[model samples]
Target: MSCCAAGAEAALQMDGIQPVSADELRLASRDLGDGTRQTDLSVPGVHCGACIAAVEKTLSALPGVESARVNLSMKRVAVKWRALDETPPDLIGALDAIGYEAHLFSSATDEKDPELSRLIKALAVAGFSAMNIMLLSVSVWSGADAATRHAFHLISAALALPAVAYSGRIFYLSAWSVLRRGRTNMDVPISIGVSLAVGLSLYETYYNAPHAYFDAATSLLFFLLIGRTLDHVMRERARSAVAGLARLSPAGTTIIAEGGERRYVPIAEIQPGAMMLIAAGDRIPVDGVVVQGASELDCSLVTGESAPLRIGVGAKVQAGLMNLTGPLTIEATTRSENSFLAEMVRMMEAAEGGRARYRRLADRAAALYSPVVHTLALLTLIGWMVLTGDWHNSITIAIAVLIITCPCALGLAVPIVQVVAARRLFERGIMVKDGSALERLAEVDTVLFDKTGTLTLGTPRLINTGEIKPEALAIAAGMAAGSRHPMASAIASSTRRSTLEQRSFDAISEHPGLGIEARSGNDLYRLGRASWALDNGGDEADTDAVSISILAKNGRILARFAFEDSIRPGSLAAVNGLRQLGMSLGIISGDRAPSVEAVASALVVDDFRAGLLPADKVAHIAKAGASGGKVLMVGDGLNDAPALASAYVSMAPATAADIGRNAADFVFLKDNLSAVKEAVDIAHRAKVLIRQNFALAIGYNAIAVPVAVFGYVTPLVAAVAMSLSSVIVVANAMRLRSPQAAPAPADTSAVSGVSLRTAAAKP
Candidate 1:
């Protein structure tokens, strides 16, 4: 029967099952801005690419539906549609027509992981039954008499029958559903093979025949269930990165009530303009401005940077940051749902959805596999019947062919490797946001780096402290302490003054983008741009340094405090390592030419561009790609966000700006730049393992399929061969867990204890 006819018949048969209504689906969906509504639904039957194609095609054909994306690893489909014209019931009906059953996905609905637990239980039952059935079959094969052999076969059948019914339902239900809709999947062949083996064995036993396949049918389920369980476990591990991020925000926050009393309230109850108390060692619950107190925040979750940022009054603190020092009183600037952390989670989900569009190796093979396997099996059966005129023998060989060519190894080939590689990267403080990141990372031939936050520590430090007198430095620091600009902060930190010295300066006022000014007795002091402080009359110092802030009193220069962003530790080693791997390196920076040159020269990078905007950085990446280069862009600022998303592959530090981290494919923790090299090396090795897995899967089918077609292999032997092939593929993938260190650089002198300073000096 055609799929449409079968689907209509199945719909008739499903009279007892209640269909989900439009109102119900609407309630489940969340508005995704711009008139789009999206909802995630659990799709249990989606095992391979064919399922993905079918589900997407069916739902996307609905009116007002914009897109339907399936994360096969998660067994969840995210559908987006125009809210004004479409409803959830419409999409659900389309899925039903296509043989898939979906329900609104809720993580809190189940306490334990229901899917994993089910797989484990089914595997246990299959394993136990297979062992007992095989033992009985061993007795029957030991040359027992007719009556004794029949008794042994009956005993084996009793154990195998229930086991198959219970454990094999996972495949049988999926196959039946698809077949009822007039389509086929990997489960179709699997269900057919298992049913035939068990049915034929039951008939042969009842008729007192010489052979029965009770052991073969049960053993196939045992091994196949093992593969299914492992696949589930790997997917769960891959999903932990997002889950870990979600756990960083507290569910409730301590709010400072109107009467000065503190009360704990759920995150939802905390609104914009609400004041909250964030104590040390607690995660900030909302995006807010610090109204009181001082502390350092561990902002790695937001920026991907390892260093803690010092926050004082008026400083903005985002949700998901851990307060590391004193308590802070903050007024919430945004609701919990719209906080920066929530935005990061949304970006990650969207990026992962995009990544899922990349077809897996297994799925690509399956698209070509289903038709060929069915045709070959059918041809083998017909050929045998024509040659020998024996229907029974022909059907037996055909069943063996189908059973042996089950795609078990092919289905497992890519996902297993990805899971293993992700786990290894996770251990090294790197989180891979998508499965395709490793593949894309492996192909990158050029590395593009941003100067600030990417190569440098991103924190400016005073470089000309020795050039100023102690009294001048103290006055500058006191004035600098009144402002929060990067240069001012550097000067303030470099010059520590006693409370008495700070008290000497009064009436300090900050000039935004220029500098800070203060009055001490009769002298008016200013520390900022030379033009602003000295009115351009001061003698100009000729230098190539990128940033220079001047300090003056009464229009006379006192001292010039030059600031430079220090290079991160291991940057030279990382650059050298990439060079050793034959990767072309370059830098694109918004900083002035001198500072950019200083960093590029320090790392021995020759290709460099300075003073580029975000769009220009993107154009630079595009130009490299146009020249046949696969670029890996590493950056950590709001300006770098666009370029990060545009690159072939991207990495960001944990301390990167929210948008930059969101756009990046991988986020590495730690202050050392060596993580970049480590990520690349791991990706290369992972690709190697993925290729080996493909080879093993294909090679197994090459040798085993012919033997089954020739009728030289029984169902029992075919089952063993199929199981062995999947095991081999998984074993090869496990090799990715071993350490894959980048080659050490030949020279460590520049990388070790090197201080980077701009060439220009201020007089």
Candidate 2:
């Protein structure tokens, strides 16, 4: 069966699926019965506020549904209703009552109505016509003969009618909507102004009057359309993360039958309990438990983690994690629909497409401001006629005022900044998940850091060892070699430096929180806790991870390994810069207290936490957030998820785990916390640029609106000045396109896991 068919069956089997909170399941009246009949709805021709309100209001009036909400953002309706024995056809009939078609917006088809495409095309025509009309209007301003001026006036009106009715349809629809709502917004004045300008301009052309301003109205529509289209494009581009999830598995899987024969099959076709074999470096074909062998899996590619994890028999794996070890046979425990990984992918998709709370002050204003400008233009014409007694001159000045104040520059301010900020971040290997992150970053005042994986390198090294040497590590290394864990690999790597001919170690053992042990020769070897090694008695003062002792030919704790991982280059400078800028810093981690304190002390950070779980980290972050300062939390572990979410704006390393990245507001690549500090500084500067741009744009209008209204300025001249002012404001905002950060000081401490090579390169 197709995915659509499968989804339908699941809906049938379960209670019901409601896309939103209240939907086709509840009725307006208490008399409505169980409305569980599957409501398959597909809305083909829905647009404008009326269509949204009409569909929602009508569908909710159906016998079963009590309430309904239409997500105009998605063009989908959700219903609440009673459980019924009927099929979805009953709900379909009810939506038809509203004089519209309603069917499920099926996921199967790639078809989309050309409504937006048509809008763009119309907008382009209006814009092109407006520009040509503007050129002709300029001739009228340059002392042309009355006949020539009149000819251009008629030409301008000829181009404007189609522009207003087609390209500016939203202006009319929105104005009508507000009136129906018994409310008023910015669009009211704009629509009123445009209506008055066009009406009077056409009258002037027909009556052979001298003051038609058709060019002015068309210019306003053109610029507004440009701003609107740019905003739409920005939003569409920001939603690529959703598209990322959609393109995740190739829509298929490999299945093993009950008879144990394997065959490639569609991911949707796999059933629970089917065994499947996955090769090294291949994605697990299904979410399942390892029934056959062991391997190290790198789920981090999808999860945004750099480290690989070991999985053995009884271990569970997801479909996207790449297997890095030997082959493993997995038994499917849940069908693809019920898999945990699948649920994660679905949730991420849903979140990306919904409820981001993306609002810019400019957008909110534009959405309402257009109508207000229209109304003002109408009122202005009436005032001029009443005051001046020259109807032709009064109407021309009103057209100039409308053209000069379309709010296009005002609308473009925030969106342009949003796009530029996102683009700058992308250039520097950062992905800001959504607009809210940037908004919060602009106001952040404090930063909370995760000590282990964020500020300090997550990789631990043997910083300095005492007397234990190569022979002492034989059993330890041999046993660890058999294991696939990170610590095992670390120890094995260190042991490989010894050129000693190795012997097979037997009876290898591991104690989860303690350590591991194995036997290589007659001389016994001990490699674990101080107590465990010292029972046979050896020195135990060293705190190194690879510390050891021996029961050998010459028994001694000889040559303990001295290992060190350095801090990332420029780390100190970044921290110092943030502090100098008056932000407080704190660190939290799940590592041992000594380990946490060691790095914290090196950096001179006053506050730090060790051994915190995900919830504990969140609590700490909430505590910081509630303290009346904007806070930035940074971490790259699963344990950091909640804390990251709770902060004003949190950053994650590119290597962060899936949950970490998901919870974080910003993601930093190159795994340098210094970049976090730099980004914050950039955000502060961008906010400043935004303020300057707004002041400039608003200032231009404040000066020009009155001049245009007083008839000291012609419509053509006003259009030129207004368009120039907007361009200047945009240019001022573009100043934030560059970043400025002092190069960070190199870290010299080898306690952290950063490389010394970068530190040495520092001037």
Candidate 3:
């Protein structure tokens, strides 16, 4: 095998095993530097908020397990414990005891998810059997003689026995696994209902009874399978974001060997201090500093800013960013496993786990559903036996109760709405990461914004280009163009019209953290920091003005170029729309007070905090929450990550740092800030629809449960009613998908002035 292929195989093999001992697990785990060891385990059975809660609770309750968090989006559980006290085998055993089958997690196994295909096959079998058995049942119901009914029932038994046994294994296996561990989930009751229906139908067929319930058992499986299939498909779709991100890093990179020879090597094989060459359009393979060459890198993935950042010698470049303009030689500072991209993945997973702690409305109902359903079924059996003294009839009625109160509608309620709402938001360039984010967003009464990238075009623009003479500008641009720095690029771009082919300098040099200078005809022309270029380190008095860079020829100051972080298009309108919605808007930033206030004034935001650290931002959010304010934080920086997690609901630009985006509940793709407003509006509409769905589910149960208990519903009627309730709930959720119901598109004009070229570079 090729070296890269072998390296890939090694990585997969390391994570592919089911760790048999604590020592084996330690090999796959990381020391978090705080006496805690963390490992990720693939728990494919996690499907809903309840599953998240169950898995976390079960593992967390174990001795030596400090914390166990499950990321529903990834279907992975991250467990942390002291290495001295616990082992991987102990935790795996705990998960198994709680009915969750887990294995060491690896990205290589993501494509091998079998649940969707399994559910689809089960659904098809159940659907085909249900239709065939129903046809047989219709003849028996139409006043057929005893022998005819018996023969039809016999045929249905022959068909449904195998079909239910095969198609119903999805529920049966889960129910049986949990029961063996002496625990119960929603599937346990469902398994009991299916088995009882099939068993009773078989008994009636044996005795040649007048009526049989072959149709009910088969039909129930078909409907339940349909729900499971839809749920699985939606969850699969939700996982695409993380999958897409994982594909951003290059499979291999060209690294300089010990003898200065270049060879293509897998990212896993590159170590710290290794030198790698990256050409234009290649994603960086590791976090490193540029040692040679210069380039404009698309750093949207790291800073959440769509602007391409110019980098040269001494500039740091992170993995996952594209080398947009030129080739670069870099010295790797970290291995691929500990690069910025990998850290982002870890941060996202951790943030998602924290968000998963929010319980959905359906889960709350489910907690009450299982005990209520079992009690009602028990009472029905006892009451029927006491009144009629017929054990067979009583057991039949009790089975009816269990099958009737299957919670099909309750199960469909939130997921259907979430699926619809998520689709709608996706169409609007908004991605909802968690199921409960919409609910939390609907409660946000206050909105907080980060200054630099969140509400403005993060690229600095030369606003004072018109003030300098064309010839002087030409000299400065020529000197600045030699270095791929942000300020240098701004100066070069602003002076593009001042180009003079005849004015070539002899040599250009850049001073680290200072300025650039070029030698022309025995005189030095400089473009850089005002003090460094002018040879005077005096503070400028005009604090509110944009930043200035000095231009000098042979120690004589020629001009100063001013730069500003331009406001994003539609920022004003987005802020206005949020205010019009009665949400209080404010700004919190780590920038200088003057810079923050300048932007805040232009946006008409009066409530603002400047020069705040990450902890300070979190403190502000906590104080707001204490005052009963539901804050919606919108930011796009590593520093904003903590504040994002602290808010009631949070959003980040797609260009945002991986940590920031992962911390946010919602991520908007477009450059427009109007997405923030649209997300909130959709959230409000979704909340209404969700409540309506719950009412429909509850109203159906309130009326149907009593009738089933009173013996007014047969097994067949109960099955039909359950299917109808589910259908009704799903149909109501579909309303969110309507075009007319969508929030009006944000004004495109709001995104003007910031050239598309700078804003279009996706991470």
TM for every model, in the order presented, reads 0.87, 0.66, 0.80
Give the residue spans of candidate 1 off by over 4 A. 1-38, 85-90, 107-110, 258-261, 287-289, 294-326, 333-358, 464-484, 492-526, 537-540, 613-616, 738-753, 759-763
**Candidate 1, residues 378-421: lDDT per residue as tens digits?**
99999999999998788789889988997767766676677677
Superposition TM-score, candidate 2 onto the true structure: 0.66
Pick by TM-score: 1 or 3, better one: 1
lDDT of 3 at 403: 71
| Residue range with the least summed lDDT across 10 consecutive positions in model 3 | 1-10
Worst 10 residues of 2 by lDDT: 1-10
lDDT of 2 by residue, 389-412 (tens): 987787777767766775656655
Model 3: what TM-score?
Answer: 0.80
User: In order, what lDDT does every prediction score?
Assistant: 0.77, 0.59, 0.74
Alpha carbon lDDT of residue 739, candidate 3?
34
Candidate 1 yields a Cα-based lDDT of 0.77
Can you list the residue pairs that collide in candidate 3?
A: 304-655, 304-656, 569-750, 569-751, 570-750
